[model samples]
Target: MPAIAVPAFALAWWLACYLISRDPKRATLRWQAAALVSYALGVAAWTMAPGSDTAEILLCVPALCWAGAVVALLPLTPTERRSVDRGALALGAAFLLMIVFLPQAGRLVVLAPLVGGLTLLWRLRAQVTPRMLPAALTVMTVLCTAALGLLLFTSGGARAAIAALGLDLLVAGYLVAVAHAAETGERLRPDLRRALAAGLAVVVLAGIPAAATMFLVPAHDGVAALQFVVLAAGATPAGLGGQVRRLLDRLALADDGPLRSDRAALFLNADALLRRRQHRRLNTVGETEFLRMTRRALHDFADLNRLARSPLTDLPSVERRLAGREDQPRARARELRAVLRESVSALRPPGPFGTTDDWRYYNVLQFCCVLGINPYARRPKTDGMSREARLAADWFRRYVPEAVTKQWIREGAMIVAERLWSEVATRRQELPAGPDGAHDTQPVNG
Candidate 1:
């Protein structure tokens, strides 16, 4: 492999594992991992053994994998999702059989899946895109178009080199972008900015030295060795070092310190809950801005993967649960989510929901936390508040520590988001099924 392909393949593999590890139960990540692995193999065969029977099988598999992954990532109905999945399998089996038995026909048959995948994308253009992600969707469209254009125009060794690399980049970029959109919607802007800067940094630090080795070294294999050495020497300190820092930060957040009043830590500290470093800090953002910021997060809860980070992960209760196993951030997040649900459920009031006497406790959590109802605003949401609710709000305003109230908001929002996301992200039947079991579009086949 070329020195550049080494890093490209390594990154693709690492990112594939990262996405799967986030939530393996999600079919989207599994399909994406399959695509990456197959695409890497397909690129290898295309550049090295384009004429062989084995190479045709290799190309056919990745094309199916790529199309299946795109269908999986979209916010499609479960029936639509399952239909495409099974259809892809059926078609892939037939395509490989043709490649094995009918050599000349199968070479032409392999392109069927790729064209089908592209056509499906064009048809589902409206449904596939998540809100506020038009730019990312546009990038994916260009990649797909470019991959086809590159394969059609290039010929000979140039075709294998350029077209193969284009397909590799296209698959990798599409999956990564989709995975990121799933995690953080608005937060993706800063993440992309950071990624762009890091990519440029790698080019400067690793690419320059590796490029020099091509001319300086005499033997071809010797040059490849030097390129790897130079690339690692540069990447280790600049790239790996930052990853190490974030990893350490994630795993070592277990400070089993006492909570206020010397109680065992059941939730986050005052400062951490308040996001002291960010503008959302209670003291930094006045009551108005605090309400505005919290409102924005609540409004966009469905797009985000997890609740805003809570200090509940540090609870000694959580520590006891993880005593035997390794300290993983993923485990901590799962435990914290469950605990937050139970914690908020305890505050539910008796009787029907309203702004009345019995509803004070639960509604306090509702207004101050989830709704961001600024009672003291110039134009507060107090018109709907009943007399008992108003008095209860005053008591909370006077007695509750501002930071602790902030903590409650964090916990309350976690509960609300968990419920909201269940509705949005659940694989339940959304749009009504059609006569054909929602497989309006069939998987591409020979």
Candidate 2:
């Protein structure tokens, strides 16, 4: 089982590394991938020389790799990418010191990575929200700490199985954490959030019996404890099945308000425009295609009002600007204007613009001017934007005076709108009829 476990873990880490490597934007995943690669190497080394002292020393590689992953997960400032390198080096140094101290430092070495991860979590508690990943990590940490204590203080067949279970929990926790981090920009629906919470609650409830069996039942062996934990974890999903169904029914009955087909259409158009930019394939060069592109770009401009309100803004700068300022009429006016300017500047595409980049800025400016989104307003005229987005709207506004006149912006927007109407009409005509023989002329939402 040990031999199989080594190879299985190695293969899983290798696959995870491969998938994470494909996306450059996944900084945390990249570090985790690197850690897994390191771990795989250590496993291979230990497998080749299981009995050797050198092989045992090589196990430190996985420990360092785990520490590296924790470092990667730290919430650093936006400008400070790759801060994990310094943290990893420091951790490596600590590991080396522990080795030099030998027998006396053995327990310290085991505790080091665990302590580091928890310390980082503690420091970032304010920034970290109460989410699925963090909750899983907390549980995993507690289990791991207990497992470590058992290993140091006691030893037997039960210890090995319990240790294996703890490792499994840690691996599961890491996977959940990475998945959550990857989708940090996504907003969770209320129903989904409730479902997740309920699922977790069920798991906790199932574990209570297991905990009682382990601690209260004095005659139970290590094997019995291990069995109970496994059974409890496994039974959680099955036990929650009825509750899950009820939650689903409740969710279905809940009103989600009217569908904004226009917003959906704009998102689709923006995606199409981005794809065209990426592929650099101008399949057709005509007035119609140009107008289509312009229409998409204009939609993107309008969408910027929502996008700019992202929580990724320079929060410190914002705080500083608004600090100690009362909400008096004059002060409120100044704050609004400042935020509007900031918001507009946030929408500006970085680097030099030509025909290639010009469309983005043009779209944003045209949308702001034509849509009549007040440059000095505290909030967007439209509702439904997230709090982060509203904050962005509060800080930034459009800049339209540079290259084009207001007249040109307005005219260009109208031209795009006219072209969009014609294109939609053409598409509706081309669409095939439904089964009942009536033409299904509903336009694509996005």
Candidate 3:
């Protein structure tokens, strides 16, 4: 791409974003403007940098700085606002300076600290909102772009390739760490404390294996290979750590499940009363209805007091509820049950799959179960016994038989697949019917 064209592209992008920002309905146009400007500035950095040498690397710093700046300026909780702003500003400034003066080596060093620090600070604040996450992601994009540009500029061939792979793993690992933090609602400092402890454990786990790899290979690249192994391992847990954090969150909020909340029932009851008054041609129906609604609200409130409360992660009881299958213990099933119990606690009501408001929790449990069943394949946990157990594990007394669990997931997956295939199938059979006809819609094999 020509150098002049880069700036032109930036200008056009900024204008588009600015126009979008003007519409009150799209109030987020301002952020979009920031994103566009950041993009243009980064492009300008590349176009104007010394030669064509590592232009992307140089540009990444400014781009990321712009992204970080945007995120920092957004409304955040007082505590979160302070930490995120401090960390983002610190990293953003450092990266920008590196872009200006030391484009080459500064790129690599900038990413490790910038991402690591932001992850630490964001987690420490224990704050997350839809806006906050997107902003954080934008900041992350800056970090990644810089790192990739640096790798492209610095090395070539096998060395560069390997380094790029390593960097990718590092980014993935950091994301996992961030996820862990989000799930736990742990302040950055507390998460770091746990990470440090886990790091020691990782060191122990890898010590001998790494040593053996080094000794057996006895080459410089061997050392690199060993290092990669450790990083990859660290990264894997960092990814899973977020999940554990979410589980912890579920456990804490265990008593807050939907079945215990009477609001839905109250609404139903009040609606019925309103209908009755309308039929009687009551003159003060509106005011009377309001009072009745309020009364119903109070009645619903009392139900919160009525339900038996217990820790969602009271593992033994959850395990017992699921019925301990003597067959290999279904480690996946048991673990999933623990997670589901937590979901039951965390979910609000009117969930898509679970018992209302708990849909998101059901979604998460299903994801974990699918991961356990077919780690190689990515599938939704929407159908099957997993979904059933996820819905009922905390509340249902019956054990989810192991075979039922597996069959449910399999059949559910099959039903979905068959229906999709049937859509495209030439001699189409009716989309296989589920037991509940239109509602169940799960396919049965002919």
Q: Which predicted model would earn the best TM-score?
A: 1
Worst 10 residues of 2 by lDDT: 275-284
Residues 1-446, model 2: lDDT tens digits: 23333333333343343334223345555555554444444333333443233433433344445555555566564234335566567777777566545652274364477467657766775555343455565565566556444433453432353334336433743553444323332122332233345444544554445445534544444643363335433433332333334455446645532333343334433322221221112221233333333433333333342222222111223335667864222232234334434444454455643223344444434345434444345654757644534443343444433234334443554444343334444543565644665533332222
Clashing pairs in 1: none
Candidate no. 2 TM-score: 0.38
| Model 3 stretches astray by more than 4 angstroms | 2-12, 19-35, 42-58, 66-76, 79-87, 112-114, 117-127, 131-147, 150-446
Ordering by TM-score: 1, 2, 3
Candidate 2, residue 272: Cα displacement in angstroms equals 14
- How accurate locally, in lDDT, is each candidate? 0.47, 0.42, 0.37
The 10-residue segment of model 1 with minimum total lDDT is 276-285
Would you estimate the TM-scores of all the predictions? 0.45, 0.38, 0.27
Please write out the lDDT profile of model 3 over residues 48-97, one tens digit for every residue: 34234344443344345334533543445445666766776677667666
Select the stronger candidate by lDDT from 1 and 3.
1
Better of 2 and 3 by lDDT: 2
Candidate 3 lDDT at 282 equals 17
* Candidate 2 C-alpha error for residue 189, in Å: 16
